[model samples]
Target: MAYSHDSVADIRSESFPDYEARIEDAYIEGYDPASLGAPHSSLHTRKLWFGLGLILAALFGIGLSVWGAAAHIWGTGTQIDLSNRLLVLGLIEVAVTLTLGFVLIASSRKGYKEYRKRTGRVN
Candidate 1:
């Protein structure tokens, strides 16, 4: 279904100005802005996608690393050597994966904060 501006009420809300400006900008560019949805600048969309992708990738990496570490430590199919260097390496992989996940989350949060700051919506 195509987007219609008539569907949205004229009653201004908190994000009305931002949305209005975007619509007006698109209209000036000879395009219907109704399809644009809310007030997302290109930079905002790119940053949001990047953040989401980073989070997803981090989650996958963390899960894979943890699984690999656990399989090494407790799986019966592999030779069990508690004092072996492989144990230490597996543990290190788990720790590093956790750290990477944390860092990705922090970076995503920071990016969101920066976006809010730029949009003057710091609250």
Candidate 2:
């Protein structure tokens, strides 16, 4: 008589087709449970602070970029040609900052949800 054996990796892959992708997503979003060592509540608080910091920084960057762009377009006394170049650069900066802000906000929300689920909190 012979017995069959299956490896853990094989079992996991068969059970969850997207297991690796899910793990990657969790890490990329900064909510990997494996990386959390503190108590659940403490981890939640730290995650909140980290997420808030990112959002605040992004907001500040966006505000500065918008101010710079506005100044380049109307406030600056430079020549039209130079001003146009600066204006374009400033606009690009504003767009980049906006995108980063959005990404940060989304990451924050996703991480918060993950934290709630892990802690079994409804609110």
Leading candidate by TM-score: 2
For candidate 2, give the lDDT of residue 103.
Answer: 61
* Candidate 2 displacement at residue 44 in angstroms: 7.6
TM-score of 2: 0.37
Q: Write the per-residue lDDT of candidate 2 for residues 15-91, one digit (tens) a residue.
A: 86873333333344444454355333334454456655655655555555566677765766654435445555655
Write model 1 residue lDDT over 81-104, tens digit each, in one string.
433444455556556655665565
CA displacement after TM-score superposition, residue 5 of candidate 2 (Å): 8.3
TM-score of each: 0.34, 0.37
Off by over 4 Å in 2: 1-80, 117-123
Pairs with backbone N, CA or C atoms under 3 Å apart (clashes), candidate 1? none
Kindly give the stretch of ten consecutive residues in candidate 2 with the minimal lDDT sum: 19-28
